[model samples]
Target: MQSTRQNSQQMDESDFYTNCRAVYLTMFKSSLENITSKEQLCTVLQQAGRNPSQKTLNKYWGPKTSKLNFDDFCEILRKEKPTGRSELMQAFREIDVNGDGFITHSELYKVLTSKGERMTREEVKAIISVADTNSDGKLDYKEFCKLFMSTTEVCQKRALERMEADNKMRRQQFGSHSEGFSKSSLSHTANPSLGTNQQAEMDVTPRKGEGKSSMRPSSARSRRASVSSTISMGASGGSKTGKLLMPKSVQDWHHTALKGCFFLEEDGEISSHQYRLDVPQTSTVFLTIKPMNLSQVEEKPSSWMSVDAMFFIVKDHEDLDDMRVVCFTELREKEKFGWKGELSSGVYYILPFTTGCRLKKKKKNIKEQAQLVCRGEGGKLALTKEFRAALSDIFEVIDLDGNGLLSLEEYNFFEQRTSGEKCDEEAWAVCKENFDTKKNELTRQGFMDLNLMEAIDRNGDPCDLWVTLESMGFNRALEMVEACPFILDAHSEECKLRLKAVNLKQSSKVLDTAICKSVMAKGEAKVMKGSESVTIYTYKNDFRITSVIANKSNQKVTIHVNSEQSKNCLSSRGISMFAVEVPPRSNVVCQHVLPINERQEWIYNCTESLVA
Candidate 1:
């Protein structure tokens, strides 16, 4: 078989070359001896359908302006010829008449038959069956290339060469053993402590109470140095104990706080958010208070001091949490806190007079909480003025009928255009039930009430932009979003609201219940609504029966399966035919399993009596 294939390939190549030489000779009309000058070579090339420039012809003729011989001309033509893949791609595109990224069977058949190739429909189907790896019943670019190039010796040789080069590269990267270099080997190269002698000794001798050593001496030395530095610093600072000193007035307190000193009161309101501190004698402090969790504060509180207005106290401490209370003028400013100016640790109490009315915290209702959780992380939902305005603009655009409402159809079109997929059914159903007050369509008010950003959350946690981007199949867009999160914010004032509205509409469309009936259903089964019971029959010739049962009742419905010719298919699978509960307003697929030759007549009975 191999020898026959090789001979066939050799014959094809020889035939190709023969056709090429015949065409060349016919176009030139003169023998190799006749062409002597650059002008003559240019004339012959131009006659052969290649308009060679004077400079290009000169390069071929050499610095002396000599003419090319017939052998050199043939070699140049061979080198200039397009590769098999390129030619195949061109042919594939030509055959793909509609340019829908695939060549249909009919398209291929028409193209082939028009070119004088005679073949039956079955023969064409057979060829496609071999090439269509994805089983889509069409020839994609890969399938078309494979079908044409697999038979060509040149393509096969090129493929083999690529495979060999890839393998060689893999071996070089992974090494011959394929185990890769150990962490110890990498650390040895990075650290200067691991000299050649120490590395050699470690390789020869295993450490005490160790089966194998993955850590090099250099890594151990580096770790010890770090530990010793930390210990020495602690020893030097720990000897001197400092006392808590209180500031005379709020102005003094503010000055000390600006110098990176914080004071925490025992009974004061402590939260992980921003607050306005209005000291009676000092300027109002607009700062964010970050309270350290117990696990983070290793050192015990040295002393607790009670001050009336505010105070500045210092101690020898490096840990941010050791100060017991830390405050930042801004969120970004918190990153600047470190053991820099003075080794500080202490808590100061402040009782500030109100400059104006304090901001009130509004209690959120359950519905609002659910929406907020969906929109932002950690229940922190604050829509910028620009973002809200953007949403309003989007809502106006989506209201195509201009009745201040978005119908289901309009919503679906918007979703299809934005996310490329329908919104999830369960999510849409929830939105309609909760946000869609009229239950007819999404009104502008209803749309605004929905947390569209949260609706795309797949994991039901806080809204994640990356997850949303990925779900929408915007992978490259997601990378850009990661690099610049503010891009979403920057563009939010324009299309953010529109994007969310589309998301909500998509969610609604995806959840709309539509049943899929068995394709094999003829007249054997009949669907009838009864006051107490519903009965369905399966065809006698049907070896398997599939039916989609939707529960329209307020409560769950259990389906009872019965068969006359065989054991209950549902019962055999350990499912209770009498107690198969279908959730309210949800659809369930009921299928009967039987042997290929076993044609069973079955009946499905559902009634109020079967409700569970």
Candidate 2:
């Protein structure tokens, strides 16, 4: 969205190169120092299978253009190709600020400001402080080059020099100590006569009148003991690995309060560091504690429960005991009561206090919600896209007039179409029969509302002869029917459904033996009868089927069709079921309601004989 501007508008080439060099040398000191020649560095990169550009190599070499001594080295580096003139000019401008063949901090700040970098006065002062080589409040060209380059080089040089000096000192000390020991050993070995005289003299004791000898072994032992004590103290003291070692005073304090012996007087300041409390069920209580930070609670101190309780901080907030205290435990012990329906995540257990306070806790160690649902009784079926498509096909079948949407009548037609079927069909019919009968035809949106509503009005009367799209002064009911398919398709598979079917008692009856087949795909089902003028029925039920019927010639297929409805009975017309080949292993079943007045013998005869 934003265009990148020129080098000067951002960072001048020279300044950028200097900064890159500084960072590179500071981070990769040995590599930068050892690889003196540009060609050698390029050779190294080539050996490593790298091909860094010349510009990148020059940038890592620091701002050498301003330093006359490095000019030849820079030229040698660029022998492969001539460097860009604009970049060299920018480098020159950086060194020769004010166009007076000299550089200064004011000039640098001006250049940075011109490039849209707004460095404050203090920041400018800091930059100047770093760049001031002579410490004379300003910089000349030569001093500027030295200071800029030294930012990276000086720190490394100082550190190396210090290491060299320390090594030299160590060597000198070792040599001198070795020579002193050799001289002492040589004198003892070469003069046994003197050694015996010395031993004899040492064996002699001072006279009783003599003052206390200065070289007493007792004094030497005391001095040696003191030195050993100091070493031990120093070893155990000072910083551990550059961090102040755990202060003994603090550790002792903790040990004394937590594990150290304490005399508990009646009301003395005994460290009440650990305690447990039992809470009653459905009861509220306030706990008081000594005013201290929650972290100081020594009872199960590592549990985050203490931190969770801290959010209720007040002048006198009570400390929580260990997590062992379960509020339900007291209830179970006393009243033999326990909560039904276990707690779930995203649901919190609130423990209310008598002081108008509460604590919230997430349910711990619980099975996931999805797993819980899966383990539910009867084993819930996964509501997948295919299942939803089936429901949409059923919805579209009911929206008869080929309208783009469904009215109450169209929706009811769907319900009625499948109401008389069995299994899921029966379930759907039982659930939605009242829904369909209560309205003429539900609009697509209206059906959605009814589906989402928890309950239906029981007392309302049913509507009859609902207005079609044409009657409603809309486009043809075909558009409405078209719209119904989409809405049904959109229905989540999770939506509970029931499918039902009806059949005649006679096994050989036209509706009994003939099968109606529908093929479903892309959320819509087409019933496949050989002819375009095939007759289908829409009962008050929720069953969906789609098909593509190949013509007798098997050349073309017709997709959508509206079936006719039967009165006071379920019927499928124009049984063009020749399109379907029945599998030998297929099981066929039929269900229908028994007339209330029918004799038990008649009902038995009707179902048993036909089913058989």
Candidate 3:
């Protein structure tokens, strides 16, 4: 059920009208009397991070005319829309009264003067004049096709005229108050979405694990509202895109994010995603992080452009600095930086941070953004059996004197290389207390136990563990691994360039969206509630276990997550409390539950709302 006014008042610490106005001005920048259509309503839904199917959108949409205002946009979203097709397309089919696959002037006049704006005879004739190509004073099927699509050479001529007319009308209607961009200009073609005669820009933003920036010709992006307490970073102008050829197992998406970041204005957060790379045993992969710049895409477009971005790889809970910095380059040097040798397996994070996207914000500075791309050769994603075998081999190598027990000197030699810390007598005593030991020396099983403890401490992060394993001489036989969820820090100033995350779990319109969308492995997604105000999407991947939450409401929804069932979750080791605040009708993978072993079950509970 919807929150009552008293609940709203009690929950909201700020002014209620301000909240109302914020919701009111969600679409068209003003809700007062400004008309919107189904297409524009779809754009608004996209801005809120939803890619609902046409059928789903149609169920929620009202009116085929440009009469759906901001209030209609609000009310339609708040209500439950069942599965259905659009009545708008059906309306035209009904207009062809003779069933001859054509519409006549009499039919058009009968409908135009009766429904919607009730156009005058002159206006009806004007529409017929654009569609009737044969000069027969009647519209055939081909002529009717011209009304909806202008992709053909014959269709473009008349459609161009109609589009220019619509542009002129839009300029006159909103005038100085609007962004002043023509639909044709934004679409880069004369074939605008037909029938509604509304303006919409198709979103083509970057996505997760991406690290390149591209410039678009459209300049109708909104300006980013500057934050007074913004943290500043140095970035150069002009970035370039690079190619990534990595380990074979998980090598599906390989594009750098366009030179921009996803910035959530309300939360002051940026977009960050993870890409897993598997380094094969006994192989060294040469890789590079390529930076990109904004290409000049417009003669006099109305927005700024991104020219640079940043990309790096790290283990879970590790920062860019914590991992090795192979090669670092600024704006000018767009060349491939350095050669990559070997990376330890087990959940490495590839973070691409782009800034200064032009299409989303009207920033005049036009600062260049950074672009990052990664490429690697073929390598199998390591499994637990492979790791155990490799570790067993290492134990043999470490027991050099033929004895299976590790003495203080032998263990200290290992301790110094992986961590640079020598184990003292007290520490050795503690190790003996926790692990299998014999005659005050660590046995083979004890050594494995010691390493297992290290893995547990890092929440199963394999970077340090692999370092220890490599030092003991086993980097040649096996490589990296899977397990544990990662974090995504996405930041786009506005909706257009947000490169919004897709909830692939939703069987809706998404394939047509940008590349690099989440690749949730095939599994049954247990949805808690129906497609109502709240939804939960779970994915089961041997590499990473994650969950997505979709909020199908107008106002912000706070979700409570309880992981009482999954006792072995590394992040908590017990029940965890999480509150996630989701935007209206948004889809986001919010939970990162990391289970310890193959036997541990991953379960999570819910609570209050979560806002980010």
Considering every candidate listed, which one attains the maximal lDDT? 3
lDDT of 2 at 451: 32
lDDT tens string, model 2, 1-612? 133553233234333222223222332322113344566555544322233566756654443222111112222333433334444446757557357645666676776556553656777778677667567655555555555455435544554444335434643543344344322232211111100000000000001122333232121111011100000111111223322122233322211000100111111111111111221222222111111111235763322221111001111112211111122111111101112121111211212111001111122443432110011255532222332233343344444344535544334434332232333445445545544333334444444334323212322211111212211111211111111110000001112111111111111111111211111012122122212111112111111111222112111111111111111211121211011211111211111211112111111111010000
After superposing candidate 3 on the true structure, give the runs of residues whose Cα lies further than 4 Å from its correct spot: 1-276, 282-286, 291-306, 312-332, 335-342, 345-353, 356-612
Ranking by lDDT: 3, 1, 2
TM agreement with the true structure for every prediction: 0.17, 0.16, 0.21
Candidate 1 or 3, higher TM-score? 3
Give me the overall lDDT of model 1: 0.33
Q: In model 1, where is the ten-residue run with the lowest total lDDT?
A: 198-207
Q: Which ten residues in a row have the lowest lDDT in candidate 3?
A: 222-231
User: lDDT per residue, candidate 3, 198-247, as tens digits?
Assistant: 11111111111222331321221111100011111112112232222333
Query: Each prediction's Cα lDDT score?
Result: 0.33, 0.25, 0.38
The reply for model 1, stretches above 4 Å from the true place, is 1-397, 417-430, 436-439, 452-612
Model 1 lDDT per residue over 1-612, tens place: 988886665455434333333333443432223346777776555433344645566656753333444434544455554346776678778777778779877788787656654666787777778777788767787666766555444533543344335434533442332234343333211111100110000000001122243333221211011100000011111222221222234233222121111211111111111111222231223222121211214565211111111111112112322322222111111111111112122222221111000111112233322222233577545443433443454454345444567666556544553344666666667768877546477776676556443534334443443233322222321211111000000011111111111122110101111112221123133332221112232322222233434333233333433222233233112222112334444444333232322133233332212211
Best TM-score goes to which candidate?
3
Worst lDDT run of 10 residues, candidate 2, spans 194-203
**All candidates: CA RMSD (Å):** 33.5, 42.4, 27.1
